[model samples]
Target: MGAAEWMQARSPEQSLTARIVRWYSFLSATLVGG
Candidate 1:
């Protein structure tokens, strides 16, 4: 999905854990690429 669409799709009620998981995965991918 487009960045804007994804940002808009994120609900305020979404759990913090979900965001943490996404952040972890993103960080892992960046580390692996580097």
Candidate 2:
């Protein structure tokens, strides 16, 4: 399956982890960009 399909198949914990990672990356990028 493709990355999008794989992401859709992920479990709840994996989704939560993904959200945390996204937030962490966003925050890190904002800090560094500023």
Candidate 3:
């Protein structure tokens, strides 16, 4: 149960990190292209 709760809490953080990474990559590509 504790492990499940920890995993649930971690999943959002991982998702947010992935989103931030994707956004950063997009911005970098746009800047480089322009």
Between candidates 1 and 2, the lDDT winner: 2
Candidate 3, which ten residues in sequence have the lowest lDDT sum?
1-10
Selected candidate, larger lDDT, 1 vs 3: 3
Q: How many backbone clashes does candidate 3 have?
A: 0
* Candidate number with greatest TM-score: 1
Candidate 3 per-residue lDDT over residues 1-34, each given as its tens digit: 5744554476766766666676688889999999
lDDT tens digits, residues 1-34, model 2?
3644455477555776786776688889999999
Error of 3 at 7 (Å): 19
CA-RMSD of model 2:
5.0
**Residue 19 CA error for candidate 2 (Å)?**
0.5
Compared with the true structure, model 3 gives a TM-score of 0.54
**CA lDDT for candidate 1:** 0.66
Runs in model 1 with CA error above 4 Å?
Answer: 1-9
Q: What is the lDDT of residue 29 in candidate 3?
A: 100
Error of 2 at 31 (Å): 0.5
- TM-score per candidate: 0.56, 0.54, 0.54
List candidate 3 stretches off by more than 4 Å: 1-13
